[model samples]
Target: MKVDSVTEKAVKAVLDKFAESYARRDLKSAMSLIAPDDDVVIYGTGADEKRVGQEAIKTQFERDWAQIEDPGLEYNWISISAAGNVAWVAIDAVLKAKVDGQNLKFQSRITMVLEKRGDRWLIVQGHFSFPDQSQFFD
Candidate 1:
């Protein structure tokens, strides 16, 4: 299948929904966008934050979000590409939050892979990480 405007739009909508869900910390909506398979994987910024299933992902989100206060995301850039029934989105943004009574901000990059299942696109894999400053500083 060739990529088309409709497919691109639908896939982009999924990314928008994911961002909305994150803003609200809506687990149900977030889970809805994830593929219902044990193979689903999501990697967070933390070294130990690799979650390899829907349940584990949910747990990690809950744990991570609990400490954040007034969470917000500022998007500096985003790109979406789709081919056939698969889409991949790349995002660059700054995440701001008040964790432990201290303000925290970091620039992070996110990449999400989605697959069209029947009529809806669901995330199969995702990764969120901060840029490694070693190369620039060294």
Candidate 2:
């Protein structure tokens, strides 16, 4: 189904808010964008990094925030599609921060699935990873 301009704008706003919250290290604001359901999932850039459920996600974020300082995030929105109450967003993002006294940077492709709850959109699943090149040589 074709996504209308209003749906696109609303989803974009939510995504932008999430990035802004993360850059500012405002955990509460960041978490507010995520669904509180037990089925919510988040996959980090690491090969095996996955967090399930709101509690697990919160714990992982706390640990990550403890090691990161002065965060900076840039999100290049690729696309957004919505069907009924669900929306998917794709973005290319760069994150930079000071971690353990060292500067760290990551460039990743991100996908987020959001479900409309009442009048607000809440992220239900999020995945972040570097572009995979394995398919090119296959």
Candidates in order, TM-scores: namely 0.89, 0.87
- Pick by TM-score: which candidate is best? 1
Tens digits of lDDT, candidate 1, 36-75: 9999999999989999999999998798789798676777
lDDT of each: 0.86, 0.86
- Compared with the true structure, model 2 gives a TM-score of 0.87
lDDT of 2 at 17: 91
Q: Candidate 1, which segments miss by more than 4 Å at Cα?
A: 1-3
User: What 10-residue stretch in candidate 1 is worst by lDDT?
Assistant: 1-10
Candidate 2 lDDT by residue in tens digits, 41-84:
99987665799998888887787777689777788656889999
